[model samples]
Target chain A: MTESPRVVGRRTDVSGPGLAGAVTDLVADCAPEMDDVLVVPDCHYAFHPSTGMVTNPDVVEALVEALASTTDVTLALPDSQWVEDAPSMLGYDALADRTGVETLALGEADTVERTVRIDDERHTVTVPKPLDEQAVVAVPTLRADPDLAAAMVTVAEAATGSRERSDVVAASAVVDPEFVLLDGTYTFTGAPHKGRFLVAGTDAPAVDRAVAPVAGLKPKAVDYLRPFGVGREAIEGLHAEDLAAELPHEQTDPNGGEQPAVMGAGYRLYAKMTGDLVPPQFSGGSDD
Target chain B: MSDLRVGLLGAGNIGTVHLQSTRGIDGASVVAAADVVPDNRARAEKQGVPRTYEDYTDLLAEEDLDAAIVALPPFLHAEATVAAAEAGCHVFVEKPFARTVEEGQRMLDAAEANDVSLGVDHTIRYQPEVQTLKEQYDAGRIGHVPLASIARINNGPFAAPPARQPVSGWMLDPDATGGGALMDLGVHLFDVLEHFFGELTVEYAHVDASMDLPYEDSALVVVSTEAGTQATVSAGFFQWETPPEITGYFRLEGVADTLRSEDHLPKQFMAHAAKSALENVSKRARGQEPAYFKPTYYYQAHYRALKDFLDAVAAGEEPPVNGAAGLRMVEHVQTAYEMAEGTRAAANAGANVEVTDD
Candidate 1:
């Protein structure tokens, strides 16, 4: 039987107490199983009540520096606006100066194709039509031809300053890929594109699960995913199921299960689909 | 078993500690423990106490006890002590004698009428280091106690439940614990300050009691005594580890000194200047005993207090740390809580609320 693809989910929510350590623990747990990991900057979420506005720029820089030096991983990022706001990107020039990986910016040039440019090298790549407008820049690399892997590796090595050849190898592998990781929050309303299937990366599903109690989403939300075209057919389809199972029942129950009105009739329906109706992992606990 | 039998009321965390302390006293034995909770009775029974009573009244009525340690919740402190006092028992009550000054006054009146020696557990002041500091302050070793500051920040007691628990828990419930860290721990600092500087009024103070719990958790209290001495007392449930440290800084006009001690532990100077002051105090208190001039005081002060109380009971004399002393500490603590409440109300209303001095 074919082994399940070894995937690593990065937790980008950097707000609240002990979250950074939690993310570190999650990454450490996934390290052994992961073939190629995508390390994103610790993202900022505006609505977290506990820590109103947290900026763990140091954490992102640390993660990027550590991933660049130690692991062979595919690092996919959003546009310049998103990248510039990222803590890791502030050190991109220095990282690029040391590592030879080329930093690329992707944007819409016209209806036909998207434009990709290496900031330092001034190198650009333009792909053909029928492209996913919302797919972002990483889509082109995932769909790129096999021969482009060598060129992409050379570019990534120059941009990242990683001496290890495997860093380039993972970067090359993710370029022009078949599957696209989408934000689970927006997937339902967002349109799907041709040739690429939408999947929740390690972080998106976790966030979706984490926010479920607070947001008051129902089983219909997971069932709604297939129809909304955002998530998987069932919550079990997400990779976090095994990890979710291990979390304490108290930590997982949102609203302290005190307000049954919020959970509604969808509770049992979602319970069957998710197997465990709640995100077992807590933001703050002894284990965390 | 026939001599100096002690009846313990409450059987909670502090009550259990009192029972442990009593076990070590030569002349005293805990014969009976009483609590409202069945589990508490079972726990007391496990400690080898022969009798356990569900009602404290029944325990007081049945046992021919010479003394009783009143360790019930703050709101119940007055009632329990008054009951124990009327039963002709010398009472050893926990700190912060009552929830309010009026209640404390009434309880003290009852003890006085009954002619029972009533002592409050002002444990910190009984510490050897604290005693040494008090001796120094009194002997004018530190020149003159100008500005004194006591700071205590602890993660709270081992019995404090996790933060996630409901706000109505015993510790958070004002009716039960009487006002969080300010009442629970601040009383210790107040007792020490009163011991060193006599009676005082709060001149300027700021307290953040409404932060996390329903009761006040943090307080910064500034007091001015009749002699015009100034003292700042700060306490909070903010530390993350055990055996919480209680530290103090005293800035005299001619000299400055610092003193630190943890619960049931040795007291020592953390700064060089404090060392010199402590040495001077030791030399004067214990002349020619140079071994006592080590800039540190070592002794289990709580155990000493327990021993003293036991000795007083045997001799039919008054306990050294009387309930009136505990009442005064509670009065100062209530003022601090009022300060915090006034500040919070003013902040919420977007205007300054005048805090009345009691």
Candidate 2:
């Protein structure tokens, strides 16, 4: 017998009290039985939240406090490609102190392999052993990673030490997170702008699909998410407001189209006037 | 005179800077380059280096170089410098000289044994503002300077905005880099301090790491020179909002007046550059050779230091900032670390225990 798919829980507030209350409400509604929960936020690097590159730490703190009610929460992040210094570099150390949430470098953690299906093919996926077996929550920012969007599914895949797009897709299924806390406190398309809202759901695929509109994308267009059996329906949410109305949904020119060209030219002229080396954009690549 | 042919070792961030600085010099040419990373080697090639190698040893062996810039990581500085000295080439090494004072001594020994000139890129002293400050202090512009303080802090060797790429892990590793902000930045301050004052004795130190990263990301060093001048040196890795957003100040408090390096800075960097270009053009038109200096004064320190080393190599003279000076900086850093370690140990020993003179 198949269990009924869980509904989504959302809250829209900019204040600290509002965010913490919203996250607590969402966690309580989605998975009340959660114990020993692992929070995987989009902490790719130590970029400021204004970049829309990483999840705001405020969102992570709210989730930690929310999870602390029924479970022990640990903030887990995958190691960076260059080195294992992502924790301090990303400013998670400060968050840990403020929230009292223990931090884990998932890359340094041991892995365990599990079988999962991807596009009708069974693949062996290795995930951090401690995290794989525990209840996980992915708190991702509202940002379009060029064509693909970074949300729960991407955050789940990042908990493992995999780089392949297909592997990330497969790993997302293996972790099988209990909830996705979509931190739309700020959203990134071409640039970051405050899109204050949060989307929470247990169904990773469904949550990703439902939030796709917030970034002005059809769920069907996200390539890695295509193979999953997720649907585009907001079954249930704490905040019954229309999220699409609140979303700016201004899509970026993925090619870096005209804006970069204009900026590059301006900088070149500035360099010439100053007798400075015609900055790299005008000089072109060293190879060129 | 023939050009001073040079080989570049390690085409990473600072290595790339050295490659650019070496290129800007009139009688210096980078003939060969080496780096473990393929991308770095490719970048070096693009910077007009004709030949590239995956290993620095290969570059040193194959290239008939008059001198080599040891721009590899702090860990490799000793091995690479020794190899260059053994190859009958002068060596200009990037700082913190070495991971330890002992390692720095070994590199110095190698240079002396081979009779090759050794120069450390202690570029802080070469900065125009720093030089101006020093000139003013020496000329009694700030009469009988009694107190001085130097601080250089930035969110570097790691930070966003300015960083086009991710920083390598080795920079954060205590074993690889010796120490964090203290070793990375303290040595530069020490060089500049010693340049203004005579010899310095490390009085006390305190180091703090924001996380459990094996080493301190921030440091505070109290030092005094033999000439009765006391100074405080503060350095950190987590101090700025962007690249080159450094909080560096060298202030001399004298009986007669107060002098600051910030006061001597070019009012507007671009305007100064434009004025310098115009002056150079005017001089060239009058059949006078234009004044020669680094293209960008911001990085002119690195260029000047390297150019001085090449000049010394060409003249068969000693480098102004020789191996001994590099070793002195390392020794100062070593003393500071030892003092910090002693403080930590004392604190730990005092924990959970009470002492009373009964």
Candidate 3:
């Protein structure tokens, strides 16, 4: 019998103050003794922090400082050859200057090819050098689709260059960070929302399971989280169900916030019957 | 006049709209279409466009077309427009009409040499709110408007939430699209701004990219007309907008009062869609083709602009929004670009001077 992974939680007004203090307290029990800490931020694309599509750069800044209390911190970055220079675009370089953290590209960083087999397939995932040797602190935004703050959770699996179910599972097994922080500052349900909450835990999958329901995502719907086992304990005053009740649920599918074509048609017909124009997006020829 | 034979050049998203819209209008019809993508060409064929081609030049040469809609990428705008003009066809080109003033002029010169009508699809001014704003301002209800501001920001070139169309790479490339948000969105704004305030002079401009793109994704351009009406235009692709709540804020301040686009916009879309759809149903019953996306004023604006251009072609007259008009807006965009470059150079020089002082 395997012991259950530990999951913890924290809540704060993302707008006010003590964000860095909150981060320090939430991650207190997870990781601090390690010499080099690799902080992975949700930066698949350079979406502005205010939109909440990407992880709040401020939160990343705070987490880096907290990690630096004991030792050196390096923010993880994907290679420019693969995707956009997300670190530079998201102003992580500036964040590094302020927090005194170094940014290293995962592809360029020293890596050992580790073969991880999940179910019927095997993948050789290339993880950052520091993670290959030491403890890891990863933060992901809760998108309405999944932290239900998750938007395909591409930031974690971007280095692998595959965005499907198996690829994410493969990477998680290899990197298995000691601490995971879910950024719920701005959540997207059917719309862009100011979702002000933070979650933390040593087990990445356990942390996500506890946080996912708060963002309107069912834990069972996520195939990847099933491997981590069910038990979750909130380290602080944070309840996923209580928060889930407050959010709008126009897009709460565990498969990500993808609305089918038929939904668009039905919505269009509804707007037509009700004597209203469907949103400008459906008509196309909007901007650019 | 007999049906004006129209050839749609580049049957992508908008091309299909044109093909479908052509069926609604009586005096003009899309006879053939061209697109490099097989899916787009097949879509045109499905829309009942008689012939489809892999290249637009083929569509221009083989068919006896009276007019051609140049909906190809901005890089190919000059070449495609020149070919259509030289082929004795009136040309209706899409936005960013040309990459630069030189290219815009070249297309205009070709049209002049060929003696064919050249129209630009500047559709914003046709939106119901915009039309209302123009009428009220012209009627002097606003009383000597001295200042105006407009912003067109959305998740452009990329999808936000309700993802439908995958972004075309050319739209993001500065060289291919001529420019970024300013060229793609600002050109349309400039055309409409000129319509309100005749002949604007570039006052100031600042262009920056938030995303990791070679070109600017956000821009603020300020201009002043001979009448002393100064307008500030904010255009960006950085914004994350949930549809039904897009940020297209346009406002005008005058001595008497203020006017806003939001005030004139259709309220509670559900009710408006019902009425609009019913009207379209009545039109279809009488052999009049039902308007597509009738409730969406933006799409209807496209339909109106295309219809107006076809009317001009059928009547053998210059389009209401012609090639020279397109050229002037292109020049305005170039002037703004030059001003932004100059501003950046001066700021750098100032920093260097401070460094020398130290």
**For model 1, how does the per-residue alpha-carbon lDDT over B76-147 read when each residue is reduced to its tens digit?**
888999999999989888777787888888888998899888888877777665676667667776566567
The complex in candidate 3 yields a DockQ of 0.19
When sorted by lDDT, best at the front, the candidate numbers are 2, 3, 1
Clashing pairs in 2: none
**Model 2: per-residue Cα lDDT over A1-288, one tens digit each:** 976466565555654798788777777767647778888887665555656657787788877877786678888877755345665655678889988888887887888888877767888877788767888888887776455455544554465544355676777777877788878787775456677777777767777777776666677777667777444655464332355555555555543322245654654454344333332323334442
For model 1 the local lDDT of residue A5 reads: 33
Q: Which CAPRI tier for candidate 1?
A: incorrect
Measure candidate 3: CA RMSD.
5.6
Estimate, for each residue in A143-222, the C-alpha lDDT of model 1 and write its tens digit: 10111111222223222323133333333232332222222211111111121111222332232333232223432343
User: A277, model 1: CA deviation in Å?
Assistant: 51
What is the fnat of candidate 2?
Answer: 0.08
lDDT by residue for model 3 over A134-182, one digit each (tens)? 6667788776543343422533453464545665666677777767887
Model 2 residue A147 lDDT score: 53
The true-versus-predicted C-alpha distance at residue B90 of model 2, in Å, is: 2.1
lDDT at B180, model 3 = 78
Model 1: residue B107 alpha-carbon error in angstroms: 1.2
